[model samples]
Target: MPAKRTALIALLAGALYLVVGVTATDSLLPAGARGGDTTTTARTDTGLVRGTRTATHTVYQGIPYAGPPKGAHRWAAPRPVRPWAGVRDATRPGPLCPQVASAYADVASLEEDCLVLNVTTGASAAARGHAPVLVWIHGDGAVGGGAYFDARRLADRGLVVVTVNYRLGVFGGFSYPGLEGSGTFALQDQQAALRWVRRNAAAFGGDPGNVTVAGSSFGAAAISGHLTSPGARGLFHRAVLASGEGMMDMPAGAMGEGVPAYPHYTWRTGQESRDTGVEMTSSLGCAGPDPRRALRCLRALPVKKVLEVPDIMNAFQAFAYGNEVLPELPEAALGQGRFLRVPLMSGATLDEHRLFVGMAHDAIGSPFTAGQYARALVTAFGRDAETVGARYPVTAFPSPALAWSTVVTDRMWARGTYAQATAFGRRTPTYAYEFADRDAPMYLPLPGAFDFGAYHAGDTPYVFEDPDAQKYFTDAQVRLSDTITDYWAQFARTGTPNRPGLVRWPRFEPGGAVPHTQSLGPDRIGPVDYAGEHRLDFWRRLAGQGTSPAPRPTEGKEQMS
Candidate 1:
């Protein structure tokens, strides 16, 4: 019976292929019609792409996989792009989502219409036939990130690399009573892009089945979200989550819990986050008194004004643990062995949170003294902070700030990621590594005194093989790009990242010898596991409990006499 079913499906596929009748690449024009330009390429789905000869490979830019989510469509599940009457320009990058004003803001111009992706592949390599695909999801605290991630180096390594831009901030993630049944829209967009790949990758000379989704920091967190999102099933075969995941269980009220906690914000009760999203929208100046009418007004507002209020938009970054989309807290789900089981490679940088804590230092008051920092550790981890601290003491670290940063990093990323990899690896194959390169550039500004050694998001340039990244590393740093790309490509092709001529990557089994994880930076090779110094016993003890201390009586700003 199974054989018959397979034969039937194959017959149907063949018939469908015949009916399609050698149509132009999915979104491109006919071959000869494209001026018969050899440098201009033709494929099945992505259409005719004109590639520019580069030092390493030809590059394709600004391909749209989904329609822009703007105006009335804001916050809706991403929609497929309308078929164009003519071949769309397959040159230059599209705009990126609105980002915080910064040096990188102009990597691609900011705009509402930014659902685009870029691909770079070696001309000679792709000419040989199918190549592996690598889709990158950038992390920007879940607020701002773009698709300018360079892939020329990775492409030179013989992979077809794609980077995507999705909606961000309130426009991309807003939830409200009016927008019911759609809290994970951004994640939905990612899955949509993956589906597009499965259908169109062949046109670009890529193997859709061999695709790997990779990201750093919040991008890593999104990778974790995808691991659990039902919508993401089968979109990609393997994942690389660098320095972030959705597993950290912070209080819902803190940091919007990565999504809105409407109840804590409004007196209204019993409304789902999306339901309350309507109320929050009006509070942010979307017009109309009636909540439903207000959402329409919101839909009509200019994207500029909407983005002007970022504090309001970032509210829905978190997904409800009970929502059908998310199902459960990431850690809880992973521990119970209920997550989407797939081959995964994930890890954190040496000092993942130095950037976060540094940004909020003034607000946190003067740096905590060694003793005070220890006490705060207990507050965060209960008795485990002591044991963890003993293992990673201020005495051992270069400074108190270093010790504090390590604790936070372990709790938020390293240990959580390790525990996640170990737990999920039990049922499925898992490979784990630690990015121990000390001289990795901190993507965000870290005060000079902090010495953000191998801080969060440092691996992106190396993975994307951004050429300008040379400013950050020496000739040795550039080679790390080749090494890391090779490891990633091997993993995407098979379940394991092992390849000849590179460091042997080990499966993440409990109590097994540590895998020599790829270290990318000033010195880009070697393996190290700092988990022992982190004292997992302490963190595990406080794992399920709430971390907030007793509510303290507080004075309002401008205290009344």
Candidate 2:
């Protein structure tokens, strides 16, 4: 079968399992529980789960870490999975959580019974003391993603890898008048998964106390949440935040506030999220004078009905803060030194926002004209638009579109990523990086005219066995992939990214005038003047509404090889 067909079949099978798991009564207490060898039939606290061992490792898929957050359990903290009676098959991955369809992923066929996880351990991991547990939280914009990374390679390097799925959209974030913990259901689900890992890491030969939480993009955003969440304390001892950080702030407001422009990493208060839920209640045909009745009615609606409601469905892409789970904005928490000080490896692709700009160009079927570029800055940054345009002039780049890409990359991602990394470094052992392969693979289509150098999510292939890597990587890129995995595994094992013979990734020292960041690319790993290269000072000044300072021309030279 074709790859797409096979993947679709797997997804359909997940939906089928979803039906079987949630048909009549409490779904967490699935009837079957497997009891066999510890490797193949590890006994979790809840029940026996029969996992499949591959030629190189033990693979366990679709293990329930939490009870189904459906029916009476919807919008509540995940209940512990009830013990089962017979052996349960742990071969196939669980259903993908509900999410909005995008140009990248179409998860319309999935369901709400998606709180599941997958684990991969080295072949001898069960022998004891060899494998360190790496719990992965897949990236999503609070909306779409599932636990499907092929971590066999990472596992081969003496690690036990765990991937997880959490609720998305309204099912994950809706908060209203009577809902006690409504705004943070997805976060609660994450904590539940961590709790499960803490309880069962030993069965798979994973060290419970050495757990490392890692994620990319939105997953990094989530790790940031966990870093700040008091409820998540002690669940994991180390973190790897890729592409996004916990304290990333966008101008706070509505999702569509920027329209054709993108919003910064802003979040909502519980009341704001509740108000959103109120509007959603009416949108879903559940509106009434009684708040309790409306919520009850909303919960009673079929999953498909919720999916069919466009706004409620799309709302999965955002999460709300200021609740018990989040309490305050993560950035604020981190700034105030109110976050867990763990070993952190956080970084982003050099041209992070270029992918989005490429998509925008693809949307209009043309490059951004100078006028359009100016208009966007004005729209996104308002009175400061001229300062932004003056700093990132169209004449300096190949086209106005590329200039716009550079502007946003530095403005929203680079500067804030640096600031947050610096903030964390003051309190924790922090390592920072930037994937600077200017000719990095184009995971998505862009006009041949546009080069999305080190585009958003560019580092993903280096970390996970994404099919795109197999499909697009050159021989040199594959070598880089190996190097990248080594860095990731080393970090998970020791809370430091350095190994015997690679570029020494320096710790981010914020008290200094210059911030040192590593650059990862094909056959290249070294330090770069990251702040100067991205003109971060200019962005900081612009954001501060102060006189903009021109950065010396990008220190284009690598400090080390």
Candidate 3:
């Protein structure tokens, strides 16, 4: 490959890693501490499990919600775990699902029996009666597990929080021509966990009927899938989607060279998934005239051998449509208002694509030049390159990289966010927000000169407790964290993120004279003209005038996982 091509591929790979990746902490407990108060116990559907009790919260870790998806169950839908006889120790988290480490993400694992969940509740949860349940799904379709997030802070806010681990990468999403659960095993795993919550939440002093599903990035996209999935209906009464790609469509050359645009960035038709799986089978030495035989051979392979296949995990990151779990594309379902009528809170960070762009250029010590920026616009927007360039001139930004980041951020992230918010607002009670804390702390261990201005997943540390995050936060940021946590807790409790003391968050009204998307910054937290700020009108006009290329129905290879 040419130098430029290699750089482009590296750039795309880094961007994909940042989009799906999240920092994983080793332990949420104090260093060297074996366990907390051992008397804290909850009876799960399987059996009684002992948990740890801290000053603020009671945590039950590594509680199996479903049977291990190993061996013959590798690509099959999740099943219930066999009931245990005695009190099980829920002191440590389970191993992560199968995945490989990358430049941006440092976590890796080959464990297939990772279908477990962690529950956190206030120390006085039993005394507080049944608190609302918040089931959290971690981001990164191929990497990162539920244990990465510490839900103690959220749990302390008078709610029962549950973080779950399902399958990841090929284990989660691999599809064969005649696979029974083609392209939906991960989703099935999530649904199974939710069902577990419904059955056993009362044991943890949680109100199962008032469950809220929440996540960021890929996890948010999964929540979007749940919103449309018939299997997920009534499992969650509320939803929170942060930096989700529910309505996102990829642009040409946006991810890498020769990468075509996709109409649905996070979805694949069953046929497309099966095609990718067939290609994988051929590469894995499991190809045969019969699809069933090929699938059996693939499933029989060792976990390490299966994971050794390059790009296998990322290839199956997308959820497959035309199946029972997700009968149609989530984007189409949202556009047609054919989804669950649950209250929703959806938003994105101010600089959603900066982390991707920064990791691509600045982190790698290759500063993006003005020439490269111009070429990127042409590559991404095609005939509308001139118009896009004119709108986002290099002179307006601090650096060429930032300028390019803004272009994609506005065109891709903001436009999709606005569309999703509008779609949700039209039919359901919707609350839209923008995490605009430009100086938010950078929690990821990324070495770069780039300014990550409230980049993608920046708000995660605020909602979940990260021990190292406090050292980077100022007093104002700490207050901002509290406010965000309060808002989320309120949303989880009552279907709305409003309270008497906090800044009033207005419900999103589509087509209103002035939109009410709350801009969440350290200094100011109130409604802002989100559409105007992101120049959604320009994008709508660009699409209306047919300057932007129409997204292809499906792509042979996915650009981002």
Name the top TM-score candidate. Answer: 3
Instruction: Give per-residue CA lDDT, model 2, range 139-212, as digits (tens).
Output: 65334444446677788888988888888767877777888786788788889999999999998888998889
* C-alpha lDDT of residue 318 in model 1: 43
Backbone clash pairs in model 2 (N, Cα, C under 3 Å; residues 3+ apart or in different chains), count: 9
| Pairwise TM-score winner, candidates 1 and 2 | 2
TM-score of each: 0.78, 0.86, 0.93
The list of candidate 2 runs beyond 4 A from truth reads 1-39, 142-145, 251-266, 445-449, 545-561
In terms of lDDT, model 3 sits at 0.81
Please state the error at residue 385 of candidate 1 in Å: 6.7
Output the lDDT of residue 19, model 1.
16
Q: Rate the local accuracy (lDDT) of all candidates.
A: 0.58, 0.70, 0.81
Name the candidate that leads on lDDT: 3
Model 2, residue 31: displacement in angstroms? 26
How many pairs of residues collide in model 1? Answer: 16
Q: Can you write out model 3's per-residue Cα lDDT over 35-97, one digit (the tens) per residue? A: 445557778779999887766677888888988887788899898799989899887777888
Collision pairs in model 3: none
Q: Write the per-residue lDDT of candidate 1 for residues 1-561, one digit (tens) a residue.
A: 001112222222222221111111222221112333445554535455555554446666667788877777777778878765545665555665754443222222347777777777776666665788889876653343333465666776678887777765455555665455345666777787788888877777788878889876556667776776676777887788776655554322122112222221211122455553654454557655575777777778766565455244444444444455566555555555666666788777776666544433422345546776676566555656677677677898766666777777766666666666666555566777666666665443223455666666656666654433446676776677667777887887776888778777666655455423444444545555545545554566556543222222232211111
